[model samples]
Target chain A: MAFATIRDVAQKAGVSITAVSQILHGKGRFSDETKALVRKTVDELGYVPDSRAQGIRLSESRTVGLLVPDIRNPFFADLVSSMEEQLYEKGYSTLIGTSAEDVQRQDAFITTLLGQRIDGAIVVPEGADSPGIRSLIDRDLPLVFVDRTVEGLDTVPSVVSDPYPGIESAVDTLRQLGHRRVGFVAHSSLGSVNVNERETAFRAIAGELLGEDGAVVVDCDNSSRSRKDALMALLAEDATAMLCAYSPDAIALIGLLHDRGMDVGEDLSVVSFDDIDAFRLMSPQVAIISQQTADMGRQGVEMLLARIGAKRKRRAENRRIPTVFVQRGSVGVAPQAR
Target chain B: MAFATIRDVAQKAGVSITAVSQILHGKGRFSDETKALVRKTVDELGYVPDSRAQGIRLSESRTVGLLVPDIRNPFFADLVSSMEEQLYEKGYSTLIGTSAEDVQRQDAFITTLLGQRIDGAIVVPEGADSPGIRSLIDRDLPLVFVDRTVEGLDTVPSVVSDPYPGIESAVDTLRQLGHRRVGFVAHSSLGSVNVNERETAFRAIAGELLGEDGAVVVDCDNSSRSRKDALMALLAEDATAMLCAYSPDAIALIGLLHDRGMDVGEDLSVVSFDDIDAFRLMSPQVAIISQQTADMGRQGVEMLLARIGAKRKRRAENRRIPTVFVQRGSVGVAPQAR
Candidate 1:
């Protein structure tokens, strides 16, 4: 990196390289004035400790790593951007890694990141008890989980969005719109406690609000074709509204409905679980269960930084960010009500 | 970093640390079989050149870096993922960096990448005359420009989308729909040659398709508030259609129209310049001039790899991908035509 060299730093500080080095190493008989000048020049030049240098721990790597489940999902991508912005303000660069929701890839990524000399990490883990996660905890690395926390790794500080509030509100809103049967497009992946929690809440609220037969669950993998097929089947069964549990897949069902000559909000309403800016641009602005994603991201970074600085492990606790229902044009009156 | 140590490598290779060191340094009197065995073990261990070891240039870093204007842009994000998948097959990890459309940040990211011993780089530049880009070219680094190219860097290979065909198709589609006056909301950035090219194409096509005083251009400075004002002025002038030049700000104008009780596709027609998969989810499905972003990314990686292999500089050519117009329900008949 052509970030200012020590020699350049010395020249700018008006001191010998030896004096600068001595001051950096906390040695030699240098005046406080000389030290201050050297420090100022170093900061001005944005000179990081050379990664090539050995036996000298001049500085810890001022970088934090983040492992997200799926970078393609705008929800996670937006969250990462927020966390990155906060970490940048603290003078830390973010190294991002995406698991793509594959356990093998997630493990490989974790192994790869361990080679980068990152000071801390924030991960939306693939599975609660994945071997890679166990190894990470064993290493005592500074880590804060976000979005989803593993069952056994509860001791790690976590920031999660509770899905119950949003689910309850969505059910009530759909019921008021004269929808007696609302189908849910559920993510196929299991073993993720976050997904499981969302599924359970969706089932309970749907039954309570729309009757026992009102709750219809269609499961499909992350593939757009699979998700669309399941959704179509649910529609054939008289589902007036499709409440998509996953944000990335929300677009899939909408596109499918359009291709089939069905209009969203008018023919069939769609309430997406995770709200993002793009959803607002749609013709019938998508109603959503707004998870406080930005808040979760900010909290994750704050907790990670705290862990990085602490001499002892702090009491790990789950920081729950509540969700709210955002009504938009997507929640139109059902055909029965009309 | 918790990567395997040299001692671990020696053990796996069934050799002494000295023997491994000698073989790695090309100074050992070892049998060719032993050398091959050591190499095999090293590869299996996913080992990279030890950057910390002084005077040891063991292996070239098998990494390719990509710099995008904004990571939050799904267009760029999808392209990066595609390129990354391709590079991974060739045993190269992709290092991603974002300029966030800031020249200073772009330069800083470039400097940072230079320190990582990256084997090659693919960049969508901030401007034509960015000093950091010039320095990379001067150093004879293997580089490929994607999406946009800087004005004086004609010798650099670039993959750019040809906007003429898409513009022509869009104008023809609008004309068929009986739209006499079409107003465009264009991006505010001027230093970007890509934006300039699109603006030129849009003006020419709109003028040819719509009669005199039928084509209107309203400049927006990236703010939703100002963009809405400019769009309102265009609508006030009796424009039948509003075409957004930038995808990100497309929402602002659409949201404002919705708030004003004007329903898109019914009250007014609209078209978007760039299209992503998510756009299909929108109600009335946003019509767009589609740029083959994935193809551009795949081609960029191939061009970069080709550059990395050649000992001498090769001919630099612009690989232009054609664009197509994707129609949905957004286009409507003008009141006079109807």
Candidate 2:
């Protein structure tokens, strides 16, 4: 059986092909009588307009691409879920690609999305500046950055969390709880803006509370084993409490502490950023700087929609969402020197 | 800056517009020098090929639509992530829509995907014989079903889990633990193929072991409050142990049991399906019937790719991935005379 095209429907409905196309694409003007006739003919003939044909006629692909660092991370999952919800409401569909923190994979995904002629892209860049991403930007594609910001890029709309306040709050809480020698376990250096803000706030607060040499910062590669080693090194310095940069690293450190037979929040206090789902169900609750993942996702869709609507006119803007510190069982007074 | 059209590029490169278009679209053969000249001109002019024009000329959208029930569910997230991984490798972009388990929403998503002129679709239908899905099948659209199959839809390829052997193994394990009265709690009725298969297998095994009267089935709506009520009712019926049909239900039931001063695995044996991420980290590990979530995602992509490649020639087939029961601490003998 042959499928009815716009031409067939137009002939059946006794209208011009452009009229049928206009009605199907929801663009241009047509009489109510003609519209109803076209609609009726489309239904009766079971005509499903070829999307490829419509896309060609409109010069718009009507699709957006999203690149995430990882999907297994609940934070990213929640973000993607929220974004999908918002985008679905607006008649836009998202093509999500997980880079898994690999720069080459991220480049490959961007290239694929570009080749597909996606209307725009929202990416969580693997690092500060990606050459492929730069090329896409240079090609004048509409792009939005989410969660993490890429340095050396100008005037791209981005949605990120302010990590400073939360870090400062955690440090203040630690100081008030009589922690003098504090350590920090960071997965990476001050490359990511969020991480930099967190580190700056942590150091300033620690220095203000306990002189110049009171704070110890251990920078490790973003891996579970590296974090475990960093935590052990920090613990060896007689640092009574440690602040973890993120949830995955915090979880790994907790397991390491458990293996060493040291009780979390009792022998050594701990706090982490990013309150992942499993943390709530763990035996020893880890204090978390909760980035509003759902809000970030919702805002991302809003920002992208705004760009899509005003692509020809509007200038780019960066929006920062705030983070809150949730005090749980992982944080407490450091054990007194015996 | 004025955008360079195919005419401009062709004029500059001293070639026909059709030749330039062919080279840009990766079609029709061209000489090495001519191809290199056109490529250089396109790069110098920073010309972005209008996908709409290409679509009109070639009749291929280069897009695939994916419809999932819930993006929040880790199982679906894993499925989607893997599909994206494979599709990106094959130079196809995915447009994802979530139905949130609402049939109306599901229908709307299908209509939208069709409207966008997606080259093909992979859907996890909310239920069997949905009219919206049936319409796609009637149109002979390239389609594949994942996770759940719609009954009466014989012409679409489907990827689903085989629960019979998994349920049999789960029951056999309970039987070895001296459980005489075993209860099963599922999210829905026997209408869903996955739930129905597990329920049927459980009843057959229970009937053979402890007579027909010994088996109990509780149909709980996919909500925490409803699951709590259903679990309470099941526990009050003198059942020795219970099997939860899904992970979310298990998480809720375990928390409820703990709140009610009942000890899992000791006072009341419990087994759940879907070994979610948090389950492994939670203390007093929950016994789980683990589906190959990542495998499901990867295999679904392979099946969808095959359907896409053989759209004009292939017949429909149903592919089943096996499930395994991962024994943890949640199963044990019934408390003596309690």
Candidate 3:
């Protein structure tokens, strides 16, 4: 027997093929009874509608393109997982692209996704002003920015944590623990919103706590060797305590300290931002400024879905998920001499 | 001026639209000079070939479907990232779906990928026997299994780790350190090839070290809560040392030991499989049996690409990547009296 197609189901259900396609795609107008009857006919007929055929008819692939900075990073992994969960529940497939923190790669990914005719995109923009991303926005493609925001594009919805408050709280807590000269080790400059916000907050809090001179910001280029160098510079400043902007840098800092025979919590108090699975398992519990990555991912999907379902165009909204300070054994009281 | 299309590029390059399309898709017979000319024309004309149009013309989409058991797991995360990198270099985009360790969810993901008309699929099968996966195989889909292998399927190529030597080494090291009553805590049953290999090797090693009745295996369902129960059971065995089969389970084991005021290395030597990111950072280092996940992913892509490019059908091949045992502070000389 020949395999039954959507045409067969539609003919059996006595409805237009367009109606059958709509019901299958979960789009267009259809009443409950009609939908149920069509579904019943589809089941009874054993009609396996070819996805390619449906795509051709609807001109919609029902796929969303997801572009992340780096998938090796645990934070992106969690984000992608959460996004997939929410998007899957809503009947959308995800096409993922990793930029590897390269602007050229980001541009290439954008072009590839666009060429694939993805329904929309959720990109963690590579830079604050990526021209390729700007072109995507210009083309009126539905875009949702996650983690970081573009400087010029105020219309793209971004789901990110308000890093300033979290940084302030972290600095305040360290200061309260009698730490005056605190050092900051960040992976990059204030180019990205999150990094800039964190550095700005750290500087503000430092000024309030111990004047502007008290805060020392060391921007590490994020390479492992460079991070080690940055750690050495930060430690050389005689800073009693240090705040890490990300997990990899924090992990590297720990290794550097251990190599130099510096006790983590005793000799140098350290706090890392962005808690990952590995961090919780580490021996000397490093204090963490943990962002709700899973929550951000879940919320980002909801926002994207809302945009997809809206009748009229919606303005871009920046949703700030909260971050909490997880104080582990890594934070200690400053010594009397220091 | 109107937006440059494939037709414009063809006209500008003085080539037939079919030839230009073929060159763009990297299909059909075309000289390198002609291909370069078309590419140069495309660049100069700023031509953007519509992916929908191209997809319709060619039955094969330049997209591979990737179905992972869980993305939040760092192992899978790192694997997916590596696969994406390799596939991207080969000009194939990846559409990712997470099954969340559910067979039903995996089935759903497969069906969705089929609907999207993915060129091929690389799945990390969640169960030993998945009927949905079987159906895909029956349909003659190009499928490659990674990390885990499904039972009763002989035609699918798979990339996995040879866990025997690693497990044996871990057991031997533990025994050398005077751990006679050693226990094993696994997150999943001995159904998966990797898990089964580890279990079989551990059992063999245990029998050699402390007779047949000495080996204690606690199989825990892969959940955070269930892992705690498994840890408790393993601890109750009064084993001098415990070998955890996975990293997340090891993290939970450490927490459980700490909660009970049991020193990890001194009271009960703890060793885990999979040296995940945070393991080294943990207060007490957890000895780990680590797999080369990146290598597995890269190899999987290479094999899949070869299959895609093969002129004649090649027989399915199974490749085993190596694993390493990194002994840190977690595994030590078993307690003096235990």
Candidate 4:
């Protein structure tokens, strides 16, 4: 329900807007009779001075804007929840804008956040180059980029997960188990720069392990109608092991295997990136390249707050949080035990 | 990133605030030099007129507030996502407030929303008796309750899934499969009235199908450390078929069974309420009672929009969405085969 503004209270009190504003602020001169009538109208209308309205006059709303990729993904959902908890403790409320991994929507939301006069912003950028984001930087608005950062905008503070350790460990473990022909199933569609980072690391490491043939990249989007066919193609390959580069791809592959009656360990070895609850609960619980999502969220807030408070333009924080491999039962000694 | 406020432009232009406001609004008398200076300053400062700040004076902010129990729950996450998509299509942005299923948090969020001047609100109430909610009703706020309703506030609009059909089907299916002893595992600690509703329906229907002795109700919360003990107790019973009253209980049971090397459909028959992604991917997919979560969200937005545009007060919407049972592989012929 909308609260009444000073104008509404003034109209109800049959007084000038100034009279109502003055009485409400407990300032300016007014007759006792008039003040009494205004006070009564205030009580009757339940008109408390809207602090948000006051915030517009002053430039401090204590509201921060958060741009996430998507909420359906539990990883991002958990990130939002954790960040909101931290922000709430610091007397700030989060206004969420989900990009859904679309660059246009990301730019539009950036425009909206700027027009809303947000005190600060934290964006999980869709792509490196967006005019709206550039405008934010030009204005010297306190901002923190998380999950991924735009290239060449190295001066902007950001927090991104280092995908190397997890990818490295996964490669080492599979190699140790004699899986030379390991296929890397990558979802190249989601616009997160982390996808590119993982792919780079994967190709480099898989190249080192099994040469160019084994550093195979399967570009698929989880939403694609042909994803199942692509999975089948990957399955028919001579590769002894398959690593799902993302959760959605992992889920899609798992479902396809379920449909084909092919067991994970016996028929194929598999792993995925980004740990999700469902991944752990699967029969042969999937191994994953895990990110510290909560820490990423918490640090993003703390860094943004630091940016917001600093009088001098502080040096940008381009920090890399580490990822690790959480191996369950999914990856097995290669099916062809070569 | 934050944008420069009106004050910033005023200060930068070396002019009085009123002079800048008048020039920007194109109102009041101002010298041409003053107007030109303000315009140039505005361009330099990138001062886009903040419509949201303007919304402070107007009752309609083109913003709707949505309160959910928790965002970490994929169920609620999906709900928020679907609702946001609909609201976005209608050119309205949603302000999200997750209560985290805490009554205190719910109340604080309620207070925050009320002060926000949101045009309308859709709440998944934590509990019914918050004075803040009652105040929204008293103030004639266009509000819709989703997922749960207050005990006496039957006059308020609401949307909830009818748990009866799903419960009834589970009992009937298990009975037809030759299970004379069916145990029902329930979780009532979520503080939603639907918990009570499901429990009552389960006991009555399961009693009718499998006798009073077979209508075993094991009550526990998902977060409780004793959920395993409760499950062990349920196992100790002579029940051949089990019906999990909620998703968390179903998940916990599945993990426990997997850990113990007890396969579903081999050691026991199981069915759960709410269709989650992981359920279908399990070795023997768990059967479930699935709710139209997306519909619940879409309808909540439509109903709130209707309430907002209503010329006169209308009877509250006590709408009930139907739930259907999705039969997966988890359920099989009772071990005793009569």
Candidate 5:
């Protein structure tokens, strides 16, 4: 159980403790052979650098906090996984938190994160206005937003999907399939910028492609009964094609459709946001607005790193990763056309 | 942008700094009004306690490192989410890492976690042998293994699912459906104790239920080619029903079946471990061996808390949560019986 310390590595490598530290930190000049010897000995002895002490001395924790609404959502899971991978490669650990889409939880996590004194943070905000986020901004910590952005936090860089291209293409596809009525099902968290943008895009594009009256919209809370009500309202409108502003809502609707013994592609065409793995594996694959989550994760980290490394203060620009429409078996000809 | 100090909170609350500290830490007696006033002032000023300093002073970071092989796996995602929730409720922040099922990455994360001076760690290990795990044990830090365990680290408490009950019930279901041949398809990560146990249970149960030659086993290397080969080999053995030891493999197999224009419930029966959301949403729902991940997460946290709170040192005991079999449309009559 004895841990190998700097002294142990130095003794074993036949070098001074100062030399070992310099070699490990890659600071002072050392011969290649000496560096190799030190590294080999460090590996053999399993010497882990005391990053806590280093963080105190160097004023850099080399750890970044990642706050997401929920990891159970596959999109967030992929985002966390991707960011962690890239961050690890850059020699930084990830501190993770889930807001559970609750403002209190988000603030609590942010409080803890600030106490940790992490070098930076990337957040998928629970809502537009968070006192915790405000504190982060006030402290001038390197921070970036991913997938979702908050209100009044315009100066912070965000990596979000541009919903227009994907919504336009989906509506056009539905129009080409002779669908005159297109409905949008949205999560009830209307404060979310992502949801607002997606719904707005759907409303504008579906209105243009299928006429103003064709664009029906309904909101559903994250519950089976609410989702059922939303679907029923959409069906009552005689809409044969629908888009889900949220992926989980789409998944629930598909299950509801199956429960009613209605074929998805046959009875009602369906498309949802986020190209999650489940959509690809479905019997009749569900089409989606691919958000390119990998790109978002990669760029979110890059933006945060850019801020962390910035020497001069300036306005941080928001970046958008374009969302693209992916057609699959979920979208088919309208029932009336059939 | 100036952070409110503890002295500022004390002044605003009309109390001494000693009283404020005592009230905040719940360490000293204070009048109810004084406590309430201090709390309100702290909240108004957003005075977050510096946990990093507290961690050093108390030698308790109030942080737990969680290392999972891959969060993209829904099972792991759920596990991480559940554990983080429970840990946070117990007043701890989670430091997260993903090994991506690589031992080097696992060791690197372990090193970083150790350097962070976390109070404890919970790991879903990559394999049966990890030098990082050995270091953790050597350090005598409170640790718990979930879902999977290591070979040499037997004394470490593990919360894993007992595969016997689920596999036995699944085999019994297949037998009742007139399936004389059953196969178990597994990921190539046979070193994982979970995979090994499930495969073993499937072999024993299938053999006992359907006679000696009824049990067939195949391994896939997480590629379409490998999964296809495994499925073809199972079909070549005339397996009317198959259980997936790993969920992703089952998902891949289902996709492969769809690619070949085969109906899962009608043409071939499919059952997979882990009752993921996607399984329930499938047109013909996939039968599953449910691991009760929420229970596992809850119990894992409880066990870790017990270890962390134990005043007297004692050897920890391993806990097993029972797995149950759920029948759905996927398991049907054998082709021959039909």
Candidate 6:
């Protein structure tokens, strides 16, 4: 039940494998009679041309490789799903790989993509420094970075959320609600470019809205103890508003807050990044800094297609998808006067 | 900066393409000098041998194709992430494609997989009948179905959740809470084998525990209007306990109940399937008929690897991961007498 290879088709059709390969690819000079014989033998032997071999002979696989930091994250899952659907509509199949935020794993996927000879690639890079990303740029692969991009690689086109508008609006809203200071909580991972950018944006915005010492930022590991410690630090700082740079942290904080008999929107105000479905289902629907994931996915694919269509010309333009603040029930006035 | 092809290597080494290919693959007779020349030329030119071309020459790709129905669904997202991790540890790269519940998309992925000459495949079939599945079977491709199986293809090995244990326990617990009947809400899509099985199991279990009419099943489309209609129909039937066969429906139903000024756990007990992260973040921390998604992902990869290692010897065994009922605040005492 093995697949009939070109050699088998050639043997059955009384020709060389090179003739069969060239005739099937519509390259090289071959008589009409020879082409007919090869086609008949191919059907008779049930030969499905190995696309990889065909890609070698023709230099196009019509397949794109994509790398995401982590698919377990809902935002990434949604982004990959949307990009896959759009690529499919444009007659390209996607090869998806997840790095799980490991630089080595990202390199491995990059090597795999190169070995597969994909037409182009879309990636959420692991961080600011990625040898794999540098290699892709060095090799001149038609590439687009989405969600996150390597720092100093401005020559590569990327689509990332601008964080400024969302952070500004959120800080302004909290300030208007009588909060003098806001606390920010996020994962302590230093390799994430987006999270670092988000935290920096919040700090600047809060400083402007509520003064120099208004931003209380805590970077914690994913352990429950660390999250609780972050919460305690916020309470000790007397910050009435809590901003989570990561959504999972927000969920964990809510659970911890509930355990301590604190109402989320009443005892302490809260807002977080990523509009995941869980936020809407929470008791007090949490406020969100929405990164337009669908637009990023669509525009990433569009940019990659344009680069591929332009024959690997590097596009130095970096596109930004502006984030917006959506106020749900999770924001409330400060428990004490300013 | 394009990749150096076999032709490029052969030209630089002053040898034929076949000689270079055979030398790289360690096949066919060639002089040591010829092999060394090809090797040196490959390194000098930075030629990454096309893995697909090598797969044709030697029928192994060290790659597997995976097909899931939807990636945006957290359950599927988690499943894919876990499976990809496991496969990566086993020295294989995964090519993932989502059907999005469209048969055409599923077939397209299948075609792409076959063209790519994958070493094997693990698919959550789109439905009971798939011409693509039939083709894989006909070609004797190493295949394993996960989460769901095609209706009449028992010859292929599969890993699916056994719904009886979870459904029976859930229904029995509701009955103990003085619920006379339980309403089951699910998608009206008839194509899903898993959802249909879950519904059927609920019917059988509820009938045994609370009499024949005790099982009320309402299948609705995914629209909000339809979900609301299904919820209203469940209320009209006077069913005090609600069993959602799908997780998203449970989320929507809970939101609708909140809007209608009804407490989920107090007014109508609820239990749904899939222990997704959102379920834990819900106000009432949903009770779930856990499918053990992590176990399913691990076992599916183990089975596929076994089959792939066995070289496509058909294994007719269907493995089942038991489902367990987890009682949370969502499964409080039903508000009616028997």
lDDT of 1 by residue, A290-320 (tens): 8878888999999999988888779997899
Candidate 6 Cα errors over 4 Å, as ranges: A1-58, A128-131, A177-180, A189-191, A213-220, A228-240, A256-268, A281-284, A332-338, B1-57, B176-181, B189-191, B212-240, B256-268, B333-338
In order, the B-chain TM-scores come to: 0.78, 0.73, 0.73, 0.78, 0.77, 0.78
Docking class of 5: acceptable
* Fnat, 2 decimals, each candidate: 0.28, 0.23, 0.35, 0.31, 0.50, 0.45
lDDT of 5 by residue, A204-256 (tens): 88877888798989999877789999999999999898899888789789878
Interface RMSD of each: 3.9, 4.5, 4.3, 3.6, 3.3, 3.0
Model-by-model DockQ, in order: 0.17, 0.15, 0.19, 0.20, 0.25, 0.26
Clashing pairs in 6: none
1 or 3, greater by DockQ: 3
Count of backbone collisions within predicted model 4: 0
Better of 1 and 4 by DockQ: 4
TM-score of each: 0.71, 0.70, 0.72, 0.76, 0.77, 0.77
Give candidate 5 regions above 4 Å deviation: A1-58, A189-191, A218-240, A255-268, A332-338, B1-58, B189-191, B216-240, B252-269, B332-338
Best DockQ among the predictions, by candidate number: 6
In candidate 3, which residue ranges exceed 4 Å CA deviation? A1-60, A128-135, A176-181, A189-193, A210-241, A252-270, A282-286, A327-338, B1-58, B128-131, B173-183, B188-193, B209-242, B252-270, B280-287, B326-338
**How are the candidates ranked when ordered by DockQ, highest leading?**
6, 5, 4, 3, 1, 2
Positional deviation of A182 in candidate 1, in angstroms?
5.4
**Count of clashing residue pairs in every prediction:** 2, 2, 10, 0, 0, 0
Candidate 2 has an interface RMSD (Å) of 4.5
Question: Which model, 2 or 4, shows the larger TM-score?
Answer: 4
User: Model 2 over residues A1-338: C-alpha lDDT tens digits?
Assistant: 23357888989999889888889778788888888889999866645455343232134556677888877677887888788777767766666667868887787666545545356788888875775676557546677899987776758889998887777788788878888889987756435566666777788878987778779998877555677679778888888888877566676676567556677788999888886755664445678888888888888878877776673746778888888889888788878733
Q: Write the per-residue lDDT of candidate 3 for residues B216-294, one digit (tens) a residue.
A: 8887765657877776776678688888876667776776675566777888888888757666655466788878788
Between prediction 3 and prediction 4, the one with superior TM-score is 4
Candidate 2 chain A: 10-residue stretch with minimal lDDT: A50-59
